[model samples]
Target: MPTLTLENDVRQFLGSITRRERRFAAAGTLITLLVLVPVVAVADPGLVPGTPAQSATEQAVDAARGDSCRDTLPADTPDYVVCRWLTPPQDAAAVAAFWGADGGANLEQAQPLPAQYVRCNRKTDLSTSTTCKGGTTFCRQLPSGWYQCTDETNGKVTYERYVNGKKQVQSTPPPSPSTTTSSTTWPTSSPTPSSPDTASTPLPTPTPPDETLPPDGNPPDAGTPTTDPTTPSASVPTVTAEPTASTTPTTPEPGNGAADGDFIATAKKARLRIWLESDLADDYLAGDTAFTAALQQLVTDAKRTDVTGVKFADNLAYTGFSTEQQVIRFLNRATQALRAALPGKRLAIGVVVPELGCGDSQPCITGLRKRAPLVTKQHVNRYLRAGDVDRVEIAGGLFGRTYRQYQVTDPKTGKPTSITPALATRAQWMSVKALEWDTLAQIGVREYGLAHTGDTSPWTMAQATAQIEARIGTAIGLGASTITLWGHKATADGQTYRLLNAGLADNPTWNGLTGQGLRGRLAVVIDPTSTERGAADIVHYAKGVSEIFILI
Candidate 1:
């Protein structure tokens, strides 16, 4: 009893315990490993009842080193790499369902346990892993529109309208790039506008011809009986284009000597251009002495007042002209009649320039291209080469001209070739939904591009400004004298025939022309007519422009 006591008591206690009981006691001591660590061979019926058993801890250590995992994985799998799902004894039966064979279960088998059996199924989404897959981008065309769809893996996706290779093969020429628009060198000595607006950048370095002012729009032989049309008039002051600072844009006051009731000649004489191209124009020029005299008399009356310069504002070369000679003759006749009425006065010509970077999405020069002819550039170049002209100026705002698909009657079929809403019979669309093939609704994105007529109404003020900048840039780049952006409606063309926000009273059109971006680069825009009046503000007289004749 002495100390058989503590030590001997414990020895007898261990010796008396059953084999299965002893294993349980050992497992309890290492409970941190896992709650129910199963010793595999313990339940073997063939083993002797009291034989020693391998410990659970030792099994776990071998598993941690991946020795147990190695046999089930591929032969090339690294020693450190474990096929975790296949290695666990408790999950063996369940994992087998995911992979038919033992060797088939590798590290890449993301799911081992079936969803229903695993109680604490904390499955991670492997797709979110940063190990990215290459080449997720894709593009294709569909009947609805062009689409570029990409990346659903980590949730980066986009389907957009894509312009395709087919754009290269378009029937019309590609739009001109903004830079290097023209071959003609811009003149450095540009005259400033009489308005408060100033120039941002200095004029280009090329010297413009000294101002000979030989009738800005006259044809080669357009001289009056008393004058030589080709000779440079030295007496005329050189219209200088010194740069200036930008100023606040303001509306032009109406009463600057322009008669209140006077309708614009362009609107009243829209058909005059077509006449100019025909034999009728030549006959009129030769025989209509009384009409020519009236034109001279009016000019003389204006000259007797305070008018400093006269500009023949029209779309002279707008669109296709049949022959260049007809234009030259018309210009010559107009120049001869007006030149004598005002001596030593500055004269100018105006025409339309094509649009660049127009529309909401796609740019189309079709409307503007339709305006340009070989004659437009030739006229300007002839004047520039002679060194007989002054600086260039621009006027007017651009509006959007929308074209719709209209229907034409089929001659043989007696049916509409393509049906628009207007053309659709009530029986087709309403009565039979499935049978309806064509309808009048616009198909897709419309071309809200350059404005040529009042057909399209007031563009946003910003669009108007952009249109002005576009025209100015083209006019200056080409060495042209004047650019008339849109046609006029002062005559009987009606309000609908209006051009460039015509019917609207308080137009933001031309407001941004005086902004620093334009004033700094191109001609300053202060003339109420959107022209760069290179003379002093006739009303204010405070800021004298370099040109001899101001708009007033």
Candidate 2:
């Protein structure tokens, strides 16, 4: 065994061993061949005293390939290139320990085997060997939420359980992925209460826009207004989104800022809030005339489309930080202008939390907690108390999954504090599962294939779809009323993989989840540019949750 030509050759040997071959090898020394190894043929039955001769077909079938299957296929096997269940050994230890205590199964003494010697069985499929026609066991789906796996060869039967769309031999339900429960009090604004029965209540649906909101809902204006509404004056410096000619309502109406008709009504009915960061201060920052024009255009567009909410936050779009007084002043002025533009509409102020990445040592969970609390107590709380805004929000970058299990280290001392997944989740900046909040639940989404995440493997369409579904579950499972799906159109070999705008509704996984009772309780984010696939998912998601947040 020339120490096996390659590492893959060793795995092939381990995967191909059969009980029958073991018996044959006992009668002789090692047989070596680069191609499929030939086995010993039985002698004539007439010459043997009590032996029965096997038919030609039986002999050929027995000699073809062993009926043994493994959790995965060996890399050197012929089908390894195309096998759907190809699972590469995770580490050197996994490869060395695969054969348990069989010390002789190492590379030096092992011979690589061909594909016909073994079959790859996926974790979901409980079916036995493909070649063992008569002796094979089959798993059948039953109505009782359990599977019946029957070994036809021995007439033996056993029950298996299906959990989270995967087949398992165990009977108990799987534990929650978070591995811990929180006793923290629920936020007052939580869409669903933390009670056990809270899942039963349907989330409140957004009222129809009375056929207004631009492209999707707004109706054309009847005519232009007789007078342009005056811009409201603010004690602090203010930059208002210039009112567009298209938005001036021809008729004067009353009720809920009806004079602001299409704009005010649309915002109220859709329950929308647009986040505007640093735009109010751009003129003061760099004297960028175009920047001011852009802000005006954004407001003008919102009014024309009947969008009502505009938020002001520092550090969202700008990299530099402004003084606390500057932020407060800007908020006051921006809110005044927004109220004047779209009277009776909601006004929100936001704070953009900065991301602290894994430095020389992992970030301590305690330190991470300090960050959120400091932001809330010092920055967000004071503004919320101002009583001028209808809503207060915090936005920031999410930590990638890779940091979840990193070794936590003290920021000042740079010493190891703890190296555990539980603590890491609590420490990560963007992981909602780890963070504890008092006033608001962060509504966000997740993505894969980005740098610095734990996941590094190339993604298949199936894997990507599964990931999106998992993210959806995690957000809703954590009591998120709204989820921001952060993803992009990724292409591999001419196929696209994405949660939004990637034609995912046609995917079987997406369609299967259609009526799983996810609607009303979960609001999903959608890209405004997703006119095709996203539109369909938005409609379905909105039908269930009552509203879809459009990412502009």
RMSD per model, one decimal:
34.3, 26.0
Local accuracy by lDDT, each model: 0.28, 0.32
Error of 2 at 490 (Å): 9.7
Cα-lDDT of candidate 2: 0.32
Provide TM-scores for the models: 0.28, 0.35
129-171 in candidate 2: lDDT tens per residue? 1232233345554444344566655756665653443335654
Off by over 4 Å in 2: 1-292, 304-308, 311-318, 348-397, 408-479, 488-497, 504-516, 524-545
Candidate 2 lDDT score at position 439: 40
Q: Give the TM-score of candidate 2.
A: 0.35
Q: Mind giving the per-residue lDDT tens digits that candidate 1 earns over 220-327? A: 110111111123541211111211112111222323433211212221222111000001132233457644544543464345323434554323433223444445
Model 1 worst lDDT run, 10 consecutive residues: 218-227
Instruction: Identify the runs in model 1 with alpha carbons over 4 angstroms from their true place.
Output: 1-286, 317-323, 329-337, 353-376, 379-493, 496-505, 514-552
Best by TM-score: 2
